[model samples]
Target: MESKSKNAPAKLHLRSGDTVKVISGNAKGETGVVKKILVDKLRATVEGVNMITKHVKPNAQNPQGSIEKLEGSIHISNLQVVDPKTGEPTRTGRKLNDKGKLQRFAKKSGNFI
Candidate 1:
């Protein structure tokens, strides 16, 4: 039997700086920019969504230990990229442009994303 861990990383359609909406969980319906992608884990961190608090240890950057609030990662499946033209969440697809270069486009708006 094949182990799940041996499976290849998930391919995500979303990219950094792309605006997205949370499709599920506590932050559902919230929109934010895709901050980072963890391909191996199939997760992405969205700004201002999934806020988490962490205890911090002081270092050169700060003399006092403090609590830090930061964005937490959400599964890639839970995010839907927002269509720039329509201002709505939409599916993404890749296709060749007139120059034959591959480009990502919004399936809903039928426009380049």
Candidate 2:
């Protein structure tokens, strides 16, 4: 069964460059900057979190095989945006700014994020 907007992408609360905290899972309590948001998958890649190792074959740059550490994507449900003012994880809300444009704000501090 298809919904009304089958082609529409899922809405994600995260955006690239936003500081976020991992609230659950192996990396729980870890904080990092959002590197990318997988809207279709509802997952986000946070820097320095969810470390994964990849075996890289020998290449021109390196004669020996190497192991690489990379940040793995985590589901959005396990992450929360950190409030800029308080430097703490806080829930977000949309509100109209003074210019009448929609903007995201930190609900905990009542300040624009």
Candidate 3:
């Protein structure tokens, strides 16, 4: 029953496998590869960032109940893609490449991300 913002883009500029840095929060300054994007919640799970523990009940896969540590989702606003060329966090921008295809680039280094 909730509606998304009309000004928000349908898709996030980030994708899986992209290296990103946490801009704010307890995990600030930590950089890691993006593991997954949760478009519905505008959150992304970065490797080794925002880790949390979960209690799991006994299941077929694991006969005994266990505690598991896993990466938790961080708000998209708290993440910035790391510029491959500059090795720094940078804002993302879109541009047309030689093939006239829209590609994401790092604003800081002006290089394709």
Which candidate gets the maximum lDDT versus the true structure? 1
Q: Cα deviation of 84 in candidate 1 (Å)?
A: 0.4
| lDDT by candidate, in order shown | 0.91, 0.90, 0.90
Residue by residue across 46-89, what tens digits does model 3's lDDT show?
99999999999998989998999999999999999899998899
Q: Which digits, one per residue and each the tens of the lDDT, describe model 1 over residues 1-113?
A: 87454677555798899999999999999999999998777799999999999999998888798999999999989999999998999999999999999999999988988
Across 1-113, the per-residue lDDT of candidate 2 in tens digits comes to 87533689865567899999999999999999998988767889999999999999998889898999998999999999999999999998889999999889999999998
Candidate 1 Cα errors over 4 Å, as ranges: 1-9, 58-63
Question: Model 3: which residue pairs collide?
Answer: none
Q: What lDDT would candidate 2 get against the real structure? A: 0.90
Candidate achieving higher TM-score, 1 or 3: 3
Per-candidate RMSD vs. true structure? 2.2, 1.8, 2.6
Which candidate number maximizes TM-score? 2
Off by over 4 Å in 3: 5-9
